[model samples]
Target: MRYIAIDVGSTFLKAAQLDVQYLAITNMESIRMPEPLPNENPLVKEWNAIQLLELMQGLIDRQLASCPGCKGIWISTQMHGFIITDEYGVAVTPYISWQDERGLEYADKLGSSYFSALMERVGEEAWRRTGLWEKPGVAAVGLFHMLQQADSGMEIEWEGQGTACPVSMNDIQTLGSKRLCTLGGYLIQSLTGSHVCHFTNAAPTGLVDVRAGEWDIDIVRAVGCQALQFPRIVVGTDIVGHYHSRWGAIPVYPDIGDHQASVLGSLADATNEAIVNMGTAGWISRVSDAYHIGEWELRPYFEGSYLPTITKLPGGRNMAVLVRFIADVGQSIYGTALTEDTLWERLLAEADRAAQYFKTGKGQSSNGQLHVHVGFYGKQTVADKGAIDNIDSDNLQVGGLFAAAMEEIAAIYERNLYVLATAGEAIEQITFTGGVIMKNAFLRDAIAKAVGIEAVMAPACDEVFHGLLRLALVSEGLYASVHETREVLLQAIL
Candidate 1:
């Protein structure tokens, strides 16, 4: 059998045709990210919907025309965006991406007490923060706090400044998720005339009701969103429906936010294996039956959600800042822009330097017990004018600093993983995925040594897309369970 998968991303739309039996990509194509609205709000849009629709339709048609074996079109859209609709289900707002920082105000006012309470209740750290970081892929609670501050009569910057919020004074209702948790449903309706943002995506929203597994009045009250305006929240793998104007009417499974699907898709086995996605960003989380919230001060995750037991560090995403900092020198010294391909080359070169650093420290044993956690979020890792702070060249030269950063990152990963492993989620093995892994061999090795597990490199590393495809197939029972899906997946890969 064959399947076609589509991933609508921030910078591009990736589409591929895979032969399920062999688990091979028969054909694949990518469309450069279309121009977005360029709005300051980032979450809201300026793109002309008609133009977007036409472009997407053309892209799909072109791909289908070229790939004869295309079985179906499965899509995973940009996460953390919302497409609200009216009573008749017409889109009321443009997509609001997680990329949008509009909610920072609200995240701030979240007040430590409220945040702590929620973390205790939901059992995840991605929602809130503790120890200077939260779980990977978690939106910044600062955004929500910022929103709250603005609402309470502070300076507010929004898409429609004078425009009122969708929430109301008497708005007391239950909500399963907040923020961009519902993008998939909007895309489904636009194409298939329906709404379907599944639970996987919804779970990340601070507003999700982990207790009830559905939106609740208390959540809406807390987060202040229009929960009722959304379509019903579906299961991550539920086959929402099908379309067959001859595009091959395969099931329209509601893919969860790509990350969650990765968790379900990359488990090494039923009991112990875990995976880390080191893409544009990096996340190291293990699959577990229990939730592990960090200490009260570490205040991670909000109430009423169940996901990532703990998070490792904040420096993974900082790689980009480091690159941008090096860009001036790259253009002048290295003579290469920090594009994806070139970035990988630079990172790989840095990895060699890291290996050298490790070699120098090897045999030190006790003296080699150095640790660091690289965080790119505060600004870029390097000191630029707008950057939070430039790396201290006095102690942190390019090569040595890279080594130190990796070491710090490794230390944080070890701390979080071991803390949980000792507590209960004894992660026996681990796999690595995402864009960062494409070149940063040192990181993979460092992580492996730090954790002391035989790290597995999933043959296909695009976790979100691959995970979505597997999720749909498994959810349909086309494969028996996650285990069966893995078997078929391994075969298809072979």
Candidate 2:
């Protein structure tokens, strides 16, 4: 059987034809994501939800037309994005990207005392119910920001003025615009006319009970949201809807979380394998049969299993930030403007050369080299700020500084892995995924050395899409369960 696997990434919308029986990808295609709307605040980002939905539908339709043997459509999308919709399932606001940081501003205006109290209460309640700690990137924070805007009587407009009128909070409440749907859920709503999300997508929203696999009404109320302010939760393998094609109706499975999907797609034995995927953000996630709330973030896995993930904001984007900063400094010092593309290549080459120096014990001179702290994730407070320390005139060069940044990232991974170790989860192997980590040998080796494990690249780079196919296969009864399908496919490949 052939399954159409679609991955809605932050940068690209990808689709592939997967031969489930042979575990092969016969064909694939990708298109860039719709251009995000510009905003005054550098931290804020939004996408045209309707445009993305229409584009995705077109892609699915084309694939189903070409692949007559396609049995189902499986979607895996980036987690934490959300869009509010009215009774007719039309978007009322722009789709907020996971990288957005308006939540911090909302929390700040609420005052430190009130904000801290609310965060503490919310975090405790969320952790207890959802096995997830309240964090900035979660949708609950975005929802809080929206509610705050609503309380101020601000007009919330969807992308493209005159495309849709600005919606007021009272209007949203009266028009039944309560639920915050994921990009996948929105697609499902557009495709099957249902406003529901899979457990994997809902797990990261800070609203669903991880163990119970249902929306927690208390968390919603604590965030000043109505009980129905979240989508109905379904399992990963549930057939949420069907797409009627010329070939016939293609069964569609509930969308899976990109993080969970990537891990499953990349790791042959997800139960024993740990992965560090570095893209816009980097995360270290390890699967466990039981749910344990540690310092790390927790996400729901297939079959009621849980993963403890440590998400760090300083990933590929941090490298880009450092490169840009160095470029600016160079332009100021030498009166020469360097192209970003050229500077990026130059910085990477320098970083690799300096990493070689560090490996040979040349960069460190007993006092230790500089430490670069990248805090591209959280608030701008000093406590959450980034810094470069212990720098001397000799080591102030790009090579050394970039090398330090790389080491700092690896050190973070090691530290987070130590947390999982302390929690009694033994990771048998470290698998690397994501374009940044997989292609960069210096960073990959640095991570392996820092984590004290041999980092093995996953079998495929597009593991997120692969994971959705696995879910789809299970949904179609090609395998008795996800575990069996994963094991069978892994056994065949390995």
Candidate 3:
């Protein structure tokens, strides 16, 4: 059997054809995400809802044309952001991105930010209920910001002026009766007319009760969006509906969270293996049958399992900071302007040369006693900033700098792994996924040495597609459960 998988991500819209029998993905493609609509306020990140839908349709049409007789369609989407749709599932507002930070703006005369006010209204219990930390970009917070604007009869544009504008007043008021869903949910509604979302995607909205697998009414009311219609939450690979493509009516599954999909695709043994995914951002996660919340965020995974994950760790984005700095220095001092690929190649080479100094038994002089903290974009708390300590003339070059940076990133992962261990989750091995880890051998080796565990890379880079294939197997009843499907797929890959 063949399946089509699509991952609607923040940076790119990716798709692939999954051959179930071989457990292989073929004909993979991706298109850059549609640029956010031009906004006067830099804080606002949004896209044209209709345009995004049209782009998705175009991609689907192309896939169907290339690979005829596709049996089913699986979807994974970026979490948190949402669009407000009318009663008929037609969008009434722009697709607000998870990167949107308008919620940080002050919402009251007393100068409480929308996020702070929403948290104040909802209380700390909401975090325990949702299994999410408070963030300005959460959908609930954005909804609250809109509610405040509508109630006050003012549409506060995110411009620094704080002047009232009535432009979005109608759209804001319409939210009281409209439906809310992620971009993937909106696509499913458009494709099959099903107003449903899987729990994996719903949990990120800060509205769903992660344990109950349903919307928390108390939290919803507290956010002042009690009247907004939320989609029916589904679990596993339940077929939401069928999309009538040119090839045939393909079974469509409710969208799953991209994080869950990628981890599932990694084929990590739930009992003993933890997955580390490093892309633009990073996450270290392990699957569990029971729910536990503490420092780690708990997300619903497939087949009644929960993922205790440490999210928003510095990854390639942080590495890029060091890379750009090196590149700028080279250009300014030596008049050498290196391309991005060239810069990475040189950086990796430098890291490789510095790796010998990082080996055990080496003295501080071997590595110039450099220690780098890579929390450039804060982890856990946004107030955190990165720092470099013990930098000396000997280790001030690119080789020592990048090596220290990679070491710091690896150390961060190791520290989080210890946190998981303290929580009684015994992780025997680590499985690495995502482009950053896959491409950078130096970083991967550094992480392995730090974690001191049996580490392996995932078999495929396109984990979301492979994960969707696993879902398809269970959904089609080819296997009884996700575990059975995983065993079969692993055997095939091996």
Candidate 4:
């Protein structure tokens, strides 16, 4: 059997043709996500809903053409972003991105940000029900921002219209009639007329009672979006609807969260191994058979399991700061425009050389003399800026600098892993995935050494696709359960 797997990622849109019987991805394709629509508020990031849908349709159509007789369509999407749709299932607003930060804007006379106000109203208990932290860019916060604007009689500018009309009070009153759809849910609705959300995807919305497996009405009311419509929550393998395509009607599954999909695809031993995925952003996660909440973020996983995760760590985005600095210096001082690939190659090569030099007891013995904190984008508690400490003349080279940065990131993983360990979820090994860790062998080794454990790369770079493929197989009844499918596939691949 064959299936089409799609990933609506934050930076890119990807699709693949999966041969379930052979456990192979016969073909895969990706395209950069469309540029966000211009907004007056720089913090507000959004995309044209219809345009994004059309782009995805083109990508899926190409995949279907290349691989005929596709039996099903499975999807995984970036979490915490959504669009508001009218009663007829047509989008009324832009597709607000997960990167959107309008929720941080001041919402009222009390000098409270939309996010802060919503957090205060929801309180700790209601917040805990969603298994999420109080943060901006989440769907609930975004909805609250809209609600506050409507309540204040303030016009919410989208796509940069100066004299935009204020969102009417009636719009707020009629919110229950409107549908809140994530990108994946919107796609499913557009393709198969299904209005459903998978638990994995829904958990990040800050509106669901994750343990209860439903939207929390109290939390919804607290956010002043009690009238807003939410989709039906489904489990991992539920078939939401069928997409009628040129090939035929293909079984369509509700989109799961990309993070969950990537971890699932890694084929890590859920009981004894954790997965560290470092892409544009990074996270260290371990699977659990039951729900347990603590300092770490809790997300719903397949087969009623849970994932204890430390998310939003520094990754490629942080690494890019140094890379861009080097590139800028080269262009400004030497008038040389370095290609991105060349820059990365040189950086990694230098980092590798530095590692080898240190291992062999180099001349200066400047080990631990330099440190790079990779928190360019603030961490969970404070908006701490990135810093470099203990830099000396002997260790102030590109190789040393990059190596220190890699070591710092590895240390972060180790520290967070200890958090999981303290919570009684210790792992003996790690399955690493994502572009950053996969491309840099030195970084992977650094992580392994830092964590004091064996580390292995995922069998495939496109872990989300593999994860969706596994889910598809289970949905088709080829596998008795996700756990069984993972064991069988892991053995086959290894």
Best by TM-score: 4
1-494: candidate 4 lDDT, tens digit per residue: 78888888878998888888888876788899988887678878888887788888787888888777778788889999987777676777788877888888885564788788888888988898888877897999988888777776766445421122222334554686788888889898888888888888887888999999988999888887767778888875777898888877878878889999999899888888889999988888888887888988889998888888888777888899999999999999999997899989998999888877877767254544578877887543221579988876677789888998998888887888888765445688889999888998988998899888888999777888878778877877887887878877776677
TM per candidate: 0.72, 0.89, 0.92, 0.94
Local accuracy of candidate 3 as per-residue lDDT tens digits, 1-494 = 77888889777898888887777888888999978877887778878787788888787778888877788788898898888887777777778877888888875562798888888888997668898878877788888878887788886542221122123545667655688878889999989988899898899999989999999998899888888888999876778999987688988889999999999899988888889999878889888888888788888998788888888777788898888888888899999998998889988998777766656435356535678877776333321578888876566666778888888888888888877664446789999999888999988998899989989999767888888888887776788887888778888877
Tens digit of per-residue lDDT, candidate 1, span 1-494: 66667666656667766555555555667777656555654333433333444455566666677766555666666544554344443433444455544432223345443334344344444333222233212332322333344366654332331132342211112222332325556555555655666665555544554434565445344444544454567744556776454555545556456656555456345356556666555556554444444431121121222344443234445565665666777788877666766765766686566557557864133334233334545322221122222333233445554655665566566666666455345677877766666557777788789888788887666666666566546544577655467666766655
Q: Measured by TM-score, how close is model 2 to the native structure?
A: 0.89
Residue 283, model 4: Cα distance from true site in angstroms: 0.5
Candidate 2 lDDT by residue in tens digits, 1-494: 88888889877899988887777776788999887787777666888777788889888888887898778888889888788877677877778877776665634456643335357657665556776555566777777676666676777554452366344445554424455789899888877777788889987777777788887777777777774456778875767887766778777778889989988887556566678788766777887787777777778888878778777535777787887788778889888888876786788799888877877988776557778887755642122567888877566778888888888887777777777664444776788888788767778888798888767988776888667767766766777777777767666667
What's model 4's TM-score?
Answer: 0.94
Which candidate do you rate higher for lDDT, 1 or 4? 4
Q: Show pairs that collide, candidate 2.
A: none
**Model 4 off-target regions past 4 Å?**
160-173, 358-368, 380-383
**In angstroms, how far off is 428's CA in candidate 3?**
0.7
Q: Name the regions of candidate 1 deviating beyond 4 angstroms.
A: 34-36, 39-59, 66-71, 87-90, 106-181, 244-251, 290-316, 332-347, 354-373, 379-396, 422-425, 475-477, 491-494
Off by over 4 Å in 3: 156-167, 330-336, 357-368, 378-383
**Cand. 3 TM to true fold:** 0.92
Tell me which of candidates 1 and 3 scores higher on lDDT.
3
Cα deviation of 190, candidate 2, in Å: 0.4
Q: What are the clashing pairs of model 4?
A: 176-227
Q: Which stretches of candidate 2 lie over 4 Å from their true place?
A: 106-123, 156-170, 175-179, 227-230, 245-247, 326-346, 358-368, 379-383, 491-494
